[model samples]
Target: MSAERVHRTTHDVTVAAPAGVVYGLISDAVQWPLYFPPNVHVEQLEFDGERERLRMWATANGEVKSWTSRRVLDAVARRVEFRQELPARPVRSMGGTWIVEPLGADRCKLTLLHDFTVDGDDPGAVAWVERATDTNSTAELANIKALAERWANLDELVLTFEDSVRVNGPAELVYDFLHRVADWPELVPHVSRLDVVEEEPGVQVMSMDTLTADGSSHTTESVRVCFPDAGRIVYKQTATPLLMSAHTGEWTVEQDETGATVVSRHSVVLREENIERVLGEGATVAAARRYVREALGRNSTATMNLAKSHAENAVTVL
Candidate 1:
């Protein structure tokens, strides 16, 4: 057993937006990677309306760490509270609350509260935990504030789109196709070269070269998390096009009594400065939005169809 010494940290920021908008963003764990730099990915293990269990990965103190957390959503109070179920090494316990208070018709304050305890009475571990909490909390507030207030400018930085196709195969087969991304070059026509390394089971670092419509290629690197049981693979791009500041996506296969379906989701945050240079002059966020839908959306559709073909064709072999 380890001694418990608690440390608490809290940070708040005022945004020029309504409380509901801020609350909605905080409540959606699956969308964190798109909005929060510290969060790499979020896995929804179980969720009822008011309660949820999630396994999440994030970069903290310059290293990737993962933990499971349970949260209670108080919609009426505009608050969410969470406690870690499986704390990482050196952390005995960690929990936090998010509070959103509306200031007026168009302003609100979002407060983040973090309370943590280190294993034993190690001062070094306590300091490390405190630093990480402060760093993450401050960044989270700034991101929320920026994203919420930007809708007013009609210049929303990030965009998300979803596409799906019916597959006449088992969900497992479709999941495997997406999980084994290294094989994409051999299977996906648009893919010319691909490489995947799994330093840890179910987590992968992948880089791929994809041919574009103009006969050129684009290379992208991403970290992927696979949930075999759920038939889901979530990924966030580490290297992206100049027009994009951030990119994250997911592939999911859902099974029903009839058959299965594969869905693809893409979220992109565009760089305003590069829009006109890369997408041509006079290009606004709207044009950038359309460009992403066509450029990124095309590849997602292709991947979905190819995976569907391979899985469905192999169904009889099962």
Candidate 2:
């Protein structure tokens, strides 16, 4: 009932913000990609009250790794505890807890705790854990602190841009066209390659390579959670573009008397430090914003138009 060998690490950060704001960031595991730097995608597999199962992909020690975790959420206690369903190699067991404590009005203390055990005291393995624990825990704390403090003015750091097209056909046709991203490589001109892996129903991991208007290319990975009944698919990019430090968005279909509207909403947070190097020297945030908006808008508009054509020309099943 107990682990043979044990190792532990703890990281604490004090933030000048309310506990609820910080806790909200941690409690919503699906949104981690948007708030936490290392998190690429988190898919909720099952949830019932305080118990939940999730699949997460994240960068640890500078390498990407995916794992399934079982979590126990305690909202009243402001705490969450989780453990890997199947621990990674060289480890017998892995578990962690997050706790948020209120210091006073507009102040809080966040704590991250990790407990684990390896086969033996392999220095290399132990060192890796130490480095990862320090790096990721500290980063999650710092990100929450900055986001909470600037929550009111986050528009300066994060931006949401969208493009939509109205199709003169049934909503089901439009939804089906957008949902089948695997067909985009052949159907959409800008999409050079699209690979999708669906290990479970309604949850998918996709890798897409896109060519922008300027001919520059980039590959991005994402996890998408589909809701056919609602005609919505929410996705978070695990691998982001050069200008965006993190990205998450959704595809939504809305129907009215006229027709159906398919929309692509992209929410991006810029990497200020890389702006000059990425966009060339002396490029400001404003310049980055304009450049990114135009580039993303072009691709989205292209996809929506493609969808519009497919829906308008195809036979409607609904």
Q: List model 2 lDDT by residue over 1-318, tens digit each.
A: 533567899989898888888788889998788989777678799999899999887667755566789999998899999998866556667899999999997999999999987766677787787788789888888888888876665677788889888788878887887889989899988989999988657767799999987797899988777879999887778788778878888888998998898889988888777899888999988998898889888888888887788878885557
RMSD of each: 3.5, 5.6
TM-score of each: 0.81, 0.68
lDDT of 1 by residue, 111-223 (tens): 99999888785999998888888888888899889788875652477788899999888888888888888888888899999988887798787889989888988898888
For candidate 2, which ten residues in a row score worst on lDDT?
A: 57-66
Relative to the true structure, candidate 1 reaches a TM of 0.81
Highest TM-score against the true fold, candidate: 1
Among all candidates shown, the one with the greatest lDDT: 1
**Model 2 clash tally?**
0
